[model samples]
Target: MPSLLEVLKFLGAGVLGLTLGVEGLSWLYRRLKPAGSSRISEVLFFPCESHCMESLFSDGRVSGDQCVCGETHSTALQSSPVDPFYRMLSHLLSARVSLDICVFSFSNFELSRAVLQLHARGVRVRVITDRDYQTIQGSQIGVLRKAGICVRHELSRSVHMHHKFCIVDGRLLLSGSLNWTMTAVQSNQENVLVTDHADIVAPYLAQFRRLWEANDPARHTHSPGNADTYAPRHHGHVHKGHYADRVKGLVHRAEVEKHTASNGHVYQQ
Candidate 1:
């Protein structure tokens, strides 16, 4: 029989191999991400400035309607989307290959619909959320899963998966204080930082890969994940679901429900 020291060395080698395998997976994931220039890089503040509510492109100086914080960005206004929320939605819709979402809660109908649309289009979509909030009323996790999207949740119940960020086509990284909930979008003061920088996006990609594997159903159940996929439909067939119109889907209610901000301060919308 092998001595204790020999067995110990054998176990150590196995552990080292596991580490290398995980690292190899991360490297492959990065290689698969289509590289591109960082065209969209900006931090967006919630409760957008009043200027965002103004008319779009009507100004002779600008081309398309995009919210431009002239005072902060440079001029009073120039060429940019005139609305912040619309910009967010547009980026979400821009995903063509893959979209990954890591957030605490997802209840906002518009955002959920956007995710569904992406899934319908063959874009591989994955969601990682806290276990508790995934089933919380108004959550769209169920909706997403029902549509054949892969959704994972935290393994522990004592702690929370409170991350609020998403990656589009493995390029654009959207990280911020905003949750994918109605209150976060239309009421609470939140912020979302959008960027496509490789250095920044790489770390998040690794973290997501870690969480996804850690929370894998196979890991927990020792069985392969049988994630559902959207069934093929007839040509030109579309899911006849209707959602509220674009960015300004709902009026930003001045009066909002009570909630706790990230700073631990209790406040109202």
Candidate 2:
């Protein structure tokens, strides 16, 4: 009934129609499918085998059995410049509950301001440092003490209170060779390790507590003539009441007050 040429032409038309229909269906499927479905399907099908690989790719996006979708897959390390004063300031500012600091020296005005600000915010703060160091001309111990922040000096004069560390909110520990001073922060080469690791924090916490208890200010007596002069109590000796009068005289004469700079640092003038 049909000629050979006509039959060939009809078969060719049918084949073309079938190919076009298949192409149209493929385009519609691609359009209707959700984005990232292929990645999810690949992950589901392969499933990362190794623990590290699984952790790296656990977000359901895979590349050759590796996860590429996890945000935390890549390790991140933070570092500070040679001058870590700003970093220290940031850490101090972020404290919500308490701050414990021990250093060989602390004379930075900016650091003093940060401590005062933290105290103002109802965050408990404590400090321990070398006794002789605080007697320096620009030392901030007097300012800190005047502000009602608990400041203590090491009892032993022979051994230097050379530790430089800070604990923030009992969670983060900052320690290393850095001293809380403008010279150490701005000029000297120093490093501070800030970590929340429990292994490292626990020991430092214990050490701080020990030092804090051993150097309690109440255990010693201050001379009335000079507030900086501290003498250990003899079991049999009683201190005269004139010591209070001397302290009042010194406070009245010194007239310590908080002087703020444009940069928010508190200085004693």
Per-residue lDDT of 201 in model 2: 77
TM-score of 1: 0.59
RMSD of each: 15.7, 25.5
lDDT of 2 at 84: 37
Q: Which pairs clash in model 2? A: 57-67
lDDT for each residue of candidate 1 in 192-257, tens digit (9 for 90 to 100): 999988889889999999989877765433213333212112254522221121111112211211
* lDDT score of residue 183 within candidate 2: 59
User: Judged by lDDT, which candidate is best?
Assistant: 1
Where does candidate 1 stray beyond 4 Å? 1-37, 48-80, 222-269
Q: Report how far residue 68 has shifted in candidate 2, in Å.
A: 46
lDDT string for model 2 (1-269, tens) is 99999999999999999999999998887678665444211100111111222222223244433545443332211222122343455666779999999988788776788888889889999999876567655788889989999988886544679998989998778888777676565456567777765556789999999999988867777658766666566674644543564455445334422223343553321
**How well does candidate 1 score on lDDT at residue 251?**
24
Candidate 2: residue 82 Cα off by (Å): 11
